[model samples]
Target: MVRREHEGSVLEAGQALRRGEVTSVELAERALAVADELGVYITRFPEHALASARRADREFAAGVDRGPLQGIPLGVKDLIAVAEAPTTAQSTVLDWGQGIDAAVTTRVKEAGGVIVGKTSTMEFGCGVPDRAKPFPIPRNPWDTERWAGGSSSGTASGIAAGMFFAGLGSDTAGSIRMPAAFCGVTGLMPTYGRVSGAGCVPLAHTLDRIGPLARTARDCAALLEVIAEVPFVAPEFTGDLTGLRVGVVREHHFPEDADPALAGVFDETLSLAEGLGATLIEVTLPYWKELTTAVLVTASCEALAHHRAELITRWPDFGVSARGIFAAGALVSGADYVQAQRVRQVVRQELARLFDDVDVIASPVASIGAPLLDDVADEAGQQNAEVFEKITTPYWNGVGNPVLAVPMGKTGDGLPLSLQLAGRLFDEATVLRAGDALQAAR
Candidate 1:
């Protein structure tokens, strides 16, 4: 029998399963109970989940193990296709029939990960929270009134609330990391092309990448090892960064008017790393504003292109926030799109040069803790959120590098603060190593 307080890490759950201390059915039931109370899932398939768990139990009894993920319960963001439920993307505009099992879904299923259900998300993976929509507005688990940084809102919130061990999330421009930071969970955005995007709804074709959100960096590594198309090796956390070189990008990354509390927490994190035997060096990023502008233009154009027909034919069906965001993409002319790509090229080149001098670059994920939902619920609040949410995550998305967002500290009101560590292209091992070390130290 699984205890009621069995909110263990992914590895701990796996160990318990191996030792016959608990069954996957018990874990799924526990997660479903939490999801029901927190409104974390957009769609729930309790019957199907229990059936899958039973099968996993039979496999373990037969001495046939899939891997670490065997019998683990996980949720799929609504944008990602799962065989058990429809992909709503939290929008009435999407065709329910279009949701099919995506590549990541198949991988998780094959690895014996029980699919709990489809979680909520921003409509089409962009836009602010809209209560007018049919879906539930995902709230931060910590306060219940604050925003869970999105567009990967549900996945991060669910993980933080212990709805499941981990879940799939997509990041086009800080979707995964932002929500994780706001919800006090860990999120990883793997290098572009590292994971297959087939079967997931497109927010921005060129910019979108799928990854995991969990309670710890090690849990993320386990999920990544199972789902990543490219071969991955989990980094060993030695609790000591003896030979690591971390580049601290503070000037352009954190604005002068940034939250003092967040900055203080970041400074403390740097000191912690130094105490662990890592050398911290100050560095400046070039074309920071240009890179950010390029991300907006590129993402807007791509998103608009993908939904042009829908926007033209059935515009009113979309949530007001999503409709407005998609409509803006129409203003991006062909030349503007091409020029944004050129800017991206230059930014990527500059980041490559910077990485030559540091093993990984560390920066604040956002300028402040999660804002109150009331502060960003309306059009004016949404606009303020767009300006006030000064995030450095999108820069790495444009540069096509792997980034890990780890919980660094909390604000006075008790909301979580996060730090992002970015590494060379396809070097998620080093990035995860750094994140793991930080978690171990904490």
Candidate 2:
């Protein structure tokens, strides 16, 4: 039951399940035993998970296998519907979903992934924690008082704390990658529209992408393969970045107030990429500011469209952080939204041209590590959240490209630093392969 054996292990759980070294129920129990301590689960389905694991064990005994996720204990984000639990999306506003599974949930069950339970998320996937509400505040496993990046909060924290091997996380503007980065796990934000969003609470319909967060890139690929309905197996790649062209971007990600240790850790990662035989070249992302702006404006407006009535009728029911964001949508003009879309197209086209020169682009996922919990829940903290989206996640989300987040190194105080690898649209294979190569070098 050592977490290290499964942390970076790709289908090692599945392998053990098939070899009779362990039954699915044991893995489920191991995940369940440590679940409550990390503030990871919004709902715990102990009996249901054991039932699913028993079925998986029976299938394995019959010499039948679903895929990489078979017999693997996985978590579904609270925002996604599960027949075993209500869809909370970490809010008191809406909790009516029941008796049916979300599309991704059905996919997970079909692949024989044992659903441990629903993991926590921010309010409707757009807010930070609010103590005024009645939900659990997700704490980082590395340091409980430190923030475990938002919207997709508990899934990443749970993975880092060994609650579950991997899980589904939705990213509209960095929910998946941000938490993954802070928690020091690997999170994949697949190309938009690549995975269906049905039955999951919508944040920004056009921007929302359902993807996997796991301990490693290989594990993310395995989960994504089932949810995305595409083949993601890479061929014998490890510490071999030969002939790989990587664009190193530092234009916006390296902010002025960045942690002093950030430069050193990020530079070491680039050196490792070079040591592994990849060519690194300096490059600037086109329309970085405009695209980031588009993301904020688009997310707020779209989210507002969904929650405007509730924001009016049940004003205080929404979290303080969620209200501030959803209210901003009221300030945007129709022309402004149109302009954002136009700029999105421009960035997408320009990035497409940029991708022709480099096989993948790389950067530090954040200029600093996780902020302290109290600091992240205050007014200044909200501004920090804006800076976070602008610098790290929005640009890629705006352009509809697949991005992979991996632990690069640690800050002086031992917080995890993350590296992101972005690929061409629908070209997750390249990024996952590169991310795996980077992680293998560790």
> Which RMSD values do the candidates have, in order?
2.3, 1.9
lDDT of 2 at 65: 88
Off by over 4 Å in 1: 1-7, 97-99, 377-382, 385-388
Estimate, for each residue in 1-442, the C-alpha lDDT of model 2 and write its tens digit: 1145446354777777778898999999998888466568899899999999999999988988899888888888999999998898888889867888988899999999999999988889876777668988888888888878887888999888888889999999889999998899999999988888988999999899999998888888888888885445544556589989999998887777888888888889999989988999999999888889998999999999999999999998887888889899999999999999999999989999999999999998888888887777556324455445433887788989999999998988788889989999888988998899888878
Clashes of each: 0, 0
- Model 1 scores what on Cα lDDT? 0.85
Worst 10 residues of 2 by lDDT: 1-10
Off by over 4 Å in 2: 1-10, 229-238, 380-391
